[model samples]
Target: MSERRTIAIAGGGIGGLIAALALARGGMRVLVYERAARFAPFGAGIQLSPNASRVLYAFGLGKALATAASEPEGLIVRRGRDAQELARGPLKGFMGQRYGAPYLILHRADLHTILRVATEKEIDIDIEMGTAVADFALHKNGVTVLTERDHQLEEHRVAALIGADGLRSTVRARMFGNDQPRPAERTAWRALVPADQLPPEFAANNVGLWLGHDAHLVHYPLRGGSVINVVAVVADAWQATWTGDGWNSPGDKDELAGRFSAWAPQVRDLIDSLPSVTRWALADRKPLRRWGEGAVTLLGDAAHPMLPFLAQGGGMAIEDAMTLGRCLVRGEDVAVALRKYERLRRYRTARVQREARRMDRIYHYSNPMAALRDMVMGARSGQKMIERYNWLYRHKS
Candidate 1:
């Protein structure tokens, strides 16, 4: 392949891998640099809204996803203190019928595997493990990328460079200068439990959300109903003291149980039954006015890290990959194409980011505000509740 037809991507996570598959299908040679020696099943469950599922199916991942993902029956919202049902929204068949795609809930690792396996099958994609994108320089011909591996450096010239690296992105820091991500002052504790270990109420084929004071809980079945993925978010003052390497740090089960002690018995029992748990501090950055310059840009968490309240983090990243691939394959100028991709994605992503932060506040309401929230939620029909997010679910890239 001509050097002018080659593109380099940093970070082989979901965004980078999906971008590789999309680019290769567009007849461009792709080089993916992943710092990890091997891919590990790290994160917990992720929800795939229709907007994201559309892109995955377009990339020909429908079969793999069908086998690995589960479409929940619906979503049930309840009060954490008394287990009072607030609202139940349609998901499984309703989502597909209305949005043209299904709402899927599955293990994050499974989706990563589906993307990785698809990328590996493409003849034009090459993955370099244990390598990181150290830096890059833009020249008249293209962008020259510097990659570091085991104290050694190598240079490769590609038509454009894409930074799909996560929160602490090296490529992003190099372009925009180093700055810390804003901490949300919240901690997320995650765990996976055997489906059989819990009572029948917890094993139902749907997503459960419990709202409380300064905390919220979300649980859903994963891995074809054999395991349940649980995530609890709570206000915490210990974020400043944490010195973990990455997001997945050991969590104290007792401490986690204590946080939910005042919750309903089912919720309390769910926490106590966990064999182990991992925790990560929740953080996000204000939307960037510009995501990239010249022939380089960012995708996924690297570009727009947001609070998980909206469940659109991975979905937005998937949309970015599809848009970037389409722009590059149009045979436009490399720098111009990148700018176009950013222009198309920046506004929508920023809105999602802002909305997620707003949801964070609503989910952890207290006293009068909590009561009002419940009353308003209860008045809306489940179908109307699902329809409220048509702008988010009906998107196509």
Candidate 2:
């Protein structure tokens, strides 16, 4: 019998988990190393548009997601100060029917749990929590992931190593030494509260985006509409030192509430309603010309991090996983497969990264520019509005 090749993945995040499942389905033996002691619930909610949802479904997660995620009726764009409707784009039936898959919004923990559970069920996969890769050594035949657990050095050999470790990836650091993430000069305050704590409008089954000067707010129901996930991103000074604390930095509720005090009462109330907030210093790296070196490569944010303005960070990572699984499963030369995967994804991911930056500017436009943005949004018909996102949602891996 031919020996089964093993693929090692660092950072068992959503992207890593998804990639593991995808590769296992393609008959590759897979191992995942996660630094967390357990796959605990962290972070806020996320949106899984059709492009990503379809990939998860392909991995046999349709029913799991159907129950854990809420399909929003549509995306409503509003003026942050007065809450005036700027544009409405359908999502639930419209996006699903149009794109052949539904657009889902769910708590990050819920989605993580779903992926974690699905990955655990795979026979060809193994997961090691509390294990962090210290570095990697690449060779012509395979790669070795080096780690130290309990004061002992451990080495893992695999046909390829995927650095899904996210923004501050150790694998990426080994490949390209001393590359740091560039702050987008913004901060995000995220919180999830019970739906009943919010007013009916805010608790509605839709994705609501309130845009203002140098700031924006997004909220939607999650876990079958029992809880509402809210995120407030604003242009702020980089208060926290660029330590290892990339995201999940502590935030003060008073400071967050005060930031939105000038907005409409309804918008302001949501910020005040949170018991506390988790602040994340928004940052990203410039798109790399290549993703990996030899038998090792990068994935997700480790390859191309971007602003969340486009809400496609997760989607892009999910897309990368699917393409990667396909390329590796083709049984081509390991180097060729890794290079092929990078070629297939580099342009699209870079484009998304650039578009996300563009959105950051547009969403934070002030005075005349903001007014002009509202005018343009209001002018686009509902269908036309959806059409703008078609290129994003209709994508299939």
Candidate 3:
């Protein structure tokens, strides 16, 4: 009988955990090395589009995910002055029904728990917490992942090394050298409020978006309508950090109101209502020259960290895990699998990168003429607008 191959997954974020779970369940011996000491499953909310939710449903995490998630009626894009919705469409679960899944917005910790619980059920996943990969050496047969402590170096010649590690991936950095990630010209301030804390208008289940001059806001419910998560974005003069301190940070409520003072009243009311908020600058990397080298290859944010305008960052990473597993499971030779995986993912992710960058201008449009152009955008009509995203939101592979 052929022996099941061994796989090493670096980084324990959503991508790493999901890849580990997928591979282990596929009958591969798996060991996941997370740099953190323990996993508390913390962080704010994230949106799971159909492209991603289908995979979660396949994992049987739908009920758990749904409990902590909410599907907005639609995405309401508004013009700043009067808060008049510039466009409205069926974007959440409404769009998901057509695509075979749902768009779910849930607290990050909840989804983490769901994945962790599912993977721990029957999989022998050796999760080495508080362990960071110091370096690596790759060969034809397998790869070695090194950490700071000497006692845990269990070297094995595996079939492949999956770098599900994130944007600042140590594996990719060791192989490709440290190229600087470009700073996106915007920063984000995120906050969450108890449902009752929100006014009656916001208490209703809906996702609200207020598009302004060089800024925008996204708000929706989470934890089965118990809490509302608000993310405000604005163009800034400086670049921001990637790793946040975890959880929402305290901010000046009046200052928060000041930033959006010119925005529509509904937006101001929401910001003004928040007792506290956390702010961070948004950062992104340009596309890598290539994503794979020998037996070591990249996945998720390590391979592509686009702008967050599409709300697909986590969803795309989940898609990466599924697509990569599909490629790897198709063959006996691991190198062939890795190559196929990279080929399948690059084009789609690159196009997403471009589209995300294009949205930067859309959110930051300050000129009157730019407003007119968008006010009558032809892309809003017909299936073309929805169809254009089909290549992304509708793909199963």
Compare the candidates by TM-score and give the number of the best one.
Answer: 1
What TM-score goes with each of the models?
Answer: 0.99, 0.96, 0.91
- Give the clashing pairs for model 1: none
Which regions of candidate 1 deviate over 4 angstroms?
none
Q: Where in model 3 is the C-alpha error above 4 Å?
A: 1-4, 149-157, 240-251, 377-388
lDDT (Cα, tens digit) per residue for candidate 3, span 1-397: 1333777788888988888777777777777778888897566888887889889888678887767677777766667667775666676655776788876778898888888877788556778788777777777576766665435655545567777777778888888888866778676788888889878767667777777777888888888888888888877744444354542245566766787888778788888777678766566688766787767788888889878888778888898888877777665578778888888888888888888888787877887854774576424753344456776778785
Please give the range of 10 consecutive residues that has the lowest summed lDDT in model 2. 237-246
CA deviation > 4 Å runs, candidate 2 = 1-4, 239-246
Which candidate tops lDDT?
A: 1
**Measured by TM-score, how close is model 2 to the native structure?**
0.96
> How many steric clashes between backbone atoms does each model show?
0, 0, 1
Cα lDDT of model 1 by residue, 1-397, tens digit: 9877899999999899999988999999999999998899868899999999999999888999999999999999998989999899999999999999999999999999998889889999999999999999999878999999998999999999999999999989999988999899889999999999999878899999999888999999999899999999999856788776765588999999999999999999999999999888899999999999899999999999999999999999999999999999999999999999999999999999999999999988888898898889988888898898999999999
Instruction: List, residue by residue over 1-397, the lDDT tens digit for candidate 2.
Output: 1223789999899899999988999999998988888877778789888999999888888898878887888889998888888888888898778999988898888888998898878999999888898988887678877976665789877788999999998888988886778888898988889988989999999999998888999999888888888999988856456465446677899988888888988998888788778888888888998888898899999999998988899999999999999999999988789999999999999989999999999999988998899889988876788788778888998
| TM-score preference between candidates 1 and 2, better one | 1
